[model samples]
Target: MPDPAANLASAMAGAYNAGDMERVILLAAQAGDEADEGILALRGLAEQATGRYDHAVETFRQLAHQQPEVSAYWNNLGVACRLRGDADAAEQALSTARSVAPHDAEVLYNLGLVYIQQRRWPLAREILLDAVDCSPGFVEARLQAAYACYVCADNIGQEAMLAGAVNWPAQPAEQALILAAMLSTQGDLDAALHTLARARLPATPEDERLRLRIAAQRAVLYERSNHLDLARQELKLLPLAALDALPDDASQARAEGWRAHAALAMRAGTWADAAALYRRVLALRVDAEARASAAFGLAASCDRLGRHGDAWQALDAAHAAQLEIAREVVPELLAPDSQPLQVAEVDRAAHARWRPLVAPSSRQSPVFVVGFPRSGTTLLEQMLDAHPEFRSMDERAFIHELTERMEQVGQRYPDELANLGGTEVEQLRATYYRMVGRVLPDLGQHRLVDKNPLNMLCLPMIMRLFPQARIVLCLRHPCDVLLSCSMQSFRSPAFMVLCSSLQRLARGYVTAFEQWFRQVEVFAPRVLEWRYESVVEDLDRHLTELAAFLEVADASPMARFADHARTKRFISTPSYAQVTQGIHPGAVNRWHGYREQFEPVLPLLQPMIDRLGYSR
Candidate 1:
């Protein structure tokens, strides 16, 4: 009498080993009544290898159910979910596998994939670190973690992560990619290009795509390196034909090319051209990010042409897209602003603990010039940056990143704060500084001026981190700021989608302003609000006032702010072009031309507008 369970397992494994998964399925069906854990796992593996994804998933589910304590089964389930593009399920299964088998390197690697797919770069870094810890020889996992760090612009950690890889495989293309990434880090973009050139395939049309990617990377690096002509040439090398490819891997390649074209067009001040490119992209990808970006571009072109109605329409679209994405990503944060006080709430509630971070010091706190997007924040930063003692970094988006982390840690409200004792708060503060330290390595005589507009909402946190930090909030007439936001195209999906509508634009401004008002009430004399109109209307008077706030010497170049448009270091913000070309009076009250279209949002904002001394 053949042992039925062993017989079934042997048959399935034999069929799977031979790559005859169809036979394996038949053997599994015959062994249905006799199938044991080994047989069931074998069937699942066979199904997965043959590309019968659903069947594989079902088989894995059943096997995991039958052997609830088997860690490998859960890990296999996670792999299947990942293959089927279910990131949430993959995370759950990988998490379960971790609990069951704490030392599983494969499970950790799979968990890292889920984080990467969800754009949780920091978590991916941590998980990959764990994977390498579990298995020091896991070279692929180390490489991926290094790549994630590179993309997130965490350059300080990248070399350290890459250094841990025990075995880095060197396929031709992969070798070139590694070299390109390394060159990019060192700011040797031309050398990066030379390395990427090695990736070119001699005869395949796909080689064009490889070339385009190389060119795109070169363009980005050159732009950052301030070689504008070289950047333009690299962008020009990207094939337009790639943008219209059929829906295959090549289609995605085309999409990437078109996206880059839209960005370059905006940078080159070819608004209409950028608008057209965005339209083509939105036709293929109808998401908030694409549509909003395109609409913003279109609005900018229309505004430039003095076509107010069209600009209004485009602006409205972009705003709407951004709100929708924000709500989806953080529902509790949007829901009437009331929710369970979790980690986030607790962090906010423990403001008293932050006093130590802000203790008085003769060493002046950094200057944070914040305002609504498309206002004079960037310009102001440039002027301030010209001073020898000020280092202006544009729109670091640090607070926004922290907000995302808060959500991840289930910090819905500050009531969650009571649960976090002094130790936890200290841990949280250390983590915050760690992230900031990576970006702002040198905090010497030069004060760090991070001019991220959205930091308006996180004034409490900013005060905690840099107690001596001076807050310089920029203000423009509601009409101009709203109009600028509507008209200016953006690369970030968050802005493109939500600020598309006049009503939404107005709502966002009101929301941000209300938050700002709350902060001023708490901080009192710590914050200095500047009106954009006043600054431009009397540059010298305002520049002197600003210098005084910073305690800068009277002779600092910032006192000669008009020269800042050319002398300041380059920053990648939406207002880059406007600041570079010197002050333009065009943006002021351009909203008046489209008054009829914007009236719907005016009622909600009328009081603020009036208070700011602007009127219809």
Candidate 2:
């Protein structure tokens, strides 16, 4: 006859396998102190399955105590602790599990989850990257890493992680849909559309839902790529109303389609249609980010329809939603400590302290376009980019990246700029050009027009490295700038955190310009101020001046900027749609429409307004 203990273990194992968790627990309880490691382990797993996390944690803790070397016991304890809302305990157990099995992917992934649960995004992405390296087919780990990248608004990081999926042998339809959307965000519309096509496999309802998602994303991409006809065709196929027709989880896809339609409607001057579409998206069960974006779109639509009160309310909601996300997910953006690169809260004293220790190099310096956000920098960039003599890269962090290298060596940027030697200067300058080459390969005969709006804060650094570089200052109505900045749903942390409120945004603008004004006094570099209202009033006049400033062969090419824009894969700014519409006074003096909302911020913005020569 079989041993009694062996027989009982076999019975309990059968019960556990059959998902008879209560019976498994009962048998384990009856065995009590007599239960072996196997019985205890099975019972602990059953507790976890039944959501008895506290009981599971205790059982796993006991098992771990009995067999301290067993990685599974420690891992189980970690999972149970995590599910029970004890991140500290989960981390402790997971760290123990990691120590026992250093290369264990499951332990690593769980550790990543602990950080993710706490909203420590950067660390979560790094740990999740470790998990992916430890094991193949850890697709969940990869997806989580991509999500972590997105949370911090690291577009480059997100693109790189999602693109790495190509190394995998195959991906399920559901996974493919997400990866495609990631590519689209990085301005690779063709690649995104291609990936979407491959995701249309006839497998299951989830696959069918995945196809629906693919179509939704494709519609948005089509519109971005300037294939409006196709975008309209794709949108007409969607707009799922019935609960059963669309998955409850298809909120993401549905929102994308709705927002695309809203954008299209706005472009067509159908404010009512745009407002309705935005309301449809707002009604969806989506996250804070999507909600923020929909609200902003609604505000814009309302503004066009002369619903100033509703527009103001929508903007308030949008900013609140974005502020919530930034505060919760990336608190460092609000008041950074160590990020000397992106931690650019520069002021007058800081600007005055800078002295150019690095002598100007003979190497050709790219022309710099500087302004605050929503100040017509993109409009200028596109017009300049339309010229055959100039090329513009997407808004880049190369300046931040360059300063990061300085921070890496325990040197602060402007503070240390006064002390740099020829060797260090050559190294930093080389690094800057190396980054430019990586993006555009060869400028050839064309001059690179570097357009990062906030690079105004880095003027001392720019002037120090390339004193002879010509800079274009795009000036707009201060009130309009603050209003537009508040209305946008920018992904960049600097904008998200700083533009959270009109007061904060005004303070930031004043501070940035104070830094700029001081740099102008100190450096006395060649500068041209292009007032935005003046440019819009006479596009031809500004185009001529721009061509003259850059020494372009023909100003006529700049006139076709709208046509040039449509051929681009995508425009990477909020003005993407507006740029294609040609020169229009729609945004000029738009702050007047929201004058009531601007009243509070007027005192803060008055000095800049008067200085910029805009009427009060």
Candidate 3:
């Protein structure tokens, strides 16, 4: 007593399971109005597999509408929509699916893919991790979560994911490349190369395209790790003369080859060569970060070649690309004006609440190096770090973490600092030192120098925790600082937004310094104003004076600062390259050349200029 529809659906299901997709689709067409949900679902899957995405989407949409409560139907609809390049529709459908079946790994995985497609790294990372939790054997879900981690710069998360992938032998070529990239970023060069080796095993001579890509990536890893000679050897394998019109992934690898070559040229200080290769990278279809880096590199090379006009053009392109990333990552803070800083403008009320306490502890306080970014903080950090007695993690956000903790506890930072008692302050101090130790395992007897430029915004909180913390206030020409901030590619979302334009950068600078001055005039924390120009003018005298200020008896190590800088594997500042060479007054007055660019933003920085003892 089998029903006709039931029998037909059973046949279609048999055909679908037996790999006869064409027959499954044909049988569904013949069934027509008599087709059951099973037959139609099989037909839709077959159509999707057979490159009939439109038909598949239509079938899935019909099923989804017919059974609104079915999570599978909704998930299928989302997958179909995603395949058809409708991200918005896919997200909507997958969100519905996720709601219908909160524990569905398939639904969560699809939604995570959609978020990754939209460059929403945090969401992608979270959702994909959820998928893995729902189904621990979801290898692809875990791998994708790791990818999202790499993009968001969550190195610890990426490393954990990589560590979990002990079954590396099962990894496909594409997955191997991703793993290699993640490994390489964490500075495990040999392991990355080993992964690439696995990807190229049982070699096929005819398909050496993948091999070339492997060589290019290897070159990039070497170059980025500062192994120039090894990078050169790999670069020789790449035909950098022309990139093929390949698909996105293949094309991107080729583009990266040119970029790696360009970065090497930049390191070698061959401006023309670097400029040419960067132009090649720009011509290719690169991701936003790569495009922005190529553009900035082009600008720097052109600037070095005495091509200020070309440099400005490239800088405009670079900043535009950077702002696009900011728009996606931090849309709320992406206003072209300086609105984000206005919230933190220390008014008279906030400053009036600051009553400095003379606190003492057995543990030595970190020397707080604060300033508007690009005010020569990097240079100061490098010089100080060269001394055997001084150590720095170079731009850790300890203060920012403290600010976030305050906000998380329903207390606004700076404004709420006045409410903290001695007990809370001691707890906070313990937390700060614990966080520092996590990054820097052994402080021993060496003084830790916390050199974060944006720490200017958290000076009040810093003083609260370490009432007698020695502050080295690095100062530069306001115009120069603003210009430098505008030029650099900062990692912080708020900073990226603030530096999107010269006007915004100037406004942030003015307000930050204004806040600092207000706190200083009242609280008067132990501070030294080290003018950047004066430091450049007298490196020896200034270094000695700085050593004296920090109470370091031996100023000899400070004299060899440039040599120490050269030995550093990496410096996390735009001035990294500059520190490798001897001190020069080169960047001191370079802002005058861009007087025209600064003309519009000059008045915004005038009061600060006067405050810092700068005539212009």
The CA lDDT of each predicted structure is 0.66, 0.79, 0.78
Which whole-number lDDT from 0 to 100 does residue 131 have in model 1?
Answer: 88
Question: Per-residue lDDT of 1-616 in model 1, one digit per residue for the tens?
Answer: 8887777778788888888988988888887666777777888887888787787788888877887789899999988988888889888988998999988898898898888788676678778878878887776676666666654445444655655232344424544666566645543455566666656354666666665666766676565545577778877777676545534556444554676676677677787777777666656646564566566666666666667777666666766665564444334444443321112222333554433432434245557778777778888888877777877655666655655565578974333433444565556666755655655567456777878787777665555445567888888888778766666655343444344456656777877776677666655536677887776687778777877777766635764544665443345665655666666776677768877877788889998888667777
| TM-score for each model | 0.69, 0.84, 0.82
Tens-place lDDT digits, model 2, residues 1-616: 7787787789899998898999998888878789899999999999999999999999999999999999989999999999999999998999899999989999999999998887777788888888878975687787777878877777656755675555443455666666766766677776666666666466665655555666677777787667888888886666545223676777776787677778778767899999998898999988888899899999988988889899989988888888778776667666632121242443556556655454553225688888988898888888889888789986876776677678878998667776777777888888888777766788776788899898887776787688888889999888888888887888865567777777778777877777688768867777889888888888888888877876665899889989988888777788888788787787878888878777887888788777777778
In model 3, how many backbone clashes occur?
Answer: 0
Higher-scoring candidate on TM-score, 1 or 3: 3
CA error at residue 360 for candidate 2, angstroms: 6.9
RMSD of 2: 4.7
In candidate 1, stretches whose alpha carbon ends up further than 4 angstroms from where it belongs are 1-69, 81-99, 102-105, 108-207, 217-226, 241-249, 266-270, 285-288, 316-324, 332-358, 397-436, 458-469, 487-500, 514-522, 559-570
For residues 1-616, write the lDDT of model 3, one tens digit per residue: 8788887788888998899999989989988876678887999999988888889999999999999999998999899988999899999999999999999988999999999888887889889889878987887787888888776655556666666464556565667778888766544567788888778433553245566667878887776655678888987878665345444556566667777778778878899999998898898777888888889889888877878778878888988888887676667777554375533544666767766555754137888888988998888898888989889876677787787788889988777788877778888888888777765779878888999887877776777787767889999988878767766776555666787778877887877887788767766778888898897777778877777777878888877878888676556567866777767677877777678878898888788789799978
Highest-TM-score candidate: 2
Evaluate model 3: give its TM-score.
0.82
Ten contiguous residues minimizing lDDT sum, candidate 3:
200-209
What pairs collide in candidate 2?
Answer: none
**Candidate order by lDDT, highest to lowest?**
2, 3, 1
Error at 131, model 2, angstroms:
4.9
